[model samples]
Target: MRIAPALLAAATLLAGCATTPMARTAGPANVPPGMQYLYGSGEAAALSEQAYNALVDSVRAQLAKGRPATAAILLPAANGTSAPGTCGDKPYAAVFDMDETAVLNLGYEYNDAQTGATYDTARWSRWEASGAEKVAAVPGARRAFVALRAMGVTPIINTNRNAAGAVPTARALAFAGLGDFKHQETLFLKGDADGKSAKDGRRAAIAARWCVLALGGDQLGDFTDALGTTPAARRRSVSSSAYADWWGRRWFVLPNPVYGTGLGSGWDDTFPASTRWTDPGDAASVAQPK
Candidate 1:
């Protein structure tokens, strides 16, 4: 008879005490280093570039053909992007999320991961203190941004990384060779006087001036979340429109398993051994620190 060893093991462990890794509760100190590696990896950056190019092109084509007025990028990955916000008569504008979307914390992420470390605020500040840090623009991003600018489309940085981050973020953009677009009012934040995470409102504010033509980002919330967190709600929204196939087409999503809602529901969420590989026996017995 085929018996799952993990089932027996879980039964044995729970019988005695909550010793399963999944059951091991976290304390104040277990807040994790956090998955801060969304940026800096060569492969990830390359993918970001590819996504950027595809997105800008999609916007160009749509605008050139006079289709949708605005597009949106969603969240749960990096923040999303949208058609730009306007300044003056510039009706063509693009909205891109800050943080990992435009500029990445690559140096910090790479160094920390290489050492099995966590995100150090001091290091982060130091890295972002200068606008001259060696940051390579995501692949194809420079050309895309430049192309959009040539098309008279304005690009704005909309992010959740706080307005204070706007300066360094701007610097990083220039350092990456992505050139500087606009900051301040152009950089929308989570709690900046706006008092909202509802990007749709933010988009409306932008549209009040310029006509946004498209949007892109790594998450769904970047688009719109009229519905709550119900999975069915999200599926119906994206699947209902022609935008279903628009995932990699117009909505360029760079892979980001780190941070964002993709992680468990909270800081305490973790993977159970049973989640994938065969469950082990006396994980506590095997979990002894080396």
Candidate 2:
């Protein structure tokens, strides 16, 4: 059959639109596990501000007068003691955690979601090899770092990111206007930490040398090693006496709903329909009645 010219044109246009990927719809699961950046950008930004303000207030309060009273040690020493913070004349400090703690590794998760893709070493290497040139500071985080520096407090960025990230990370921080924090040796990566599983060793080291007035990060581990084996342990650690004093007082934590060890095991250990799948009432159904 012969088609009308306008009808043919309309069919072509409709076909093009039909082939396009659908706008992701909301469901019981709107976002997947690895797509926190795509799902939680606002939360991450809010957390960054919280950490920044905590450091600023802690530093200002510490250096106000007589002596450093309240301080959050980044790592405790090997012997379980904190290094005192003193430098000829300078008083206290504030230590920061990189990754979600300081700058959002949002790209890894963000790209995955936007492109409807998954993570792989090859992809991550490309992400890193690109020098993370597009990386940005955790919202207000860099400003907080600079502010602490301005207050005469040492600002240290401790990260788990490998050395390959050093140059790019530094540049990004600089571009974000975070002034230079001397003592070149302080950016801590995984291998740099001592035997202590807890940051005690590092915190102690910093405490021994620098008066850490406050500490900020997304995870509890950044503040103290008290966060234990299980999720419950971690919860307990946060409420424990030693950390009780520091919680929210000398430490500020940013939100990290994307990735962390915090999420309890779900259907993840077995075959699941999707990356973000969670076990339904299946487990409870199998449990014996008490």
Best by lDDT: 2
lDDT of each: 0.54, 0.56
Return the number of clashes found in candidate 1: 19
lDDT of 1: 0.54
TM-score of 1: 0.61
Top candidate by TM-score: 2
lDDT of 2: 0.56
RMSD of each: 11.6, 12.8
TM-score of each: 0.61, 0.67
Q: Score residue 216 of candidate 2 by CA lDDT.
A: 80
* Candidate 2 structure quality by residue, lDDT tens digits, 83-129: 33343444556777766566655555555444544345466557655
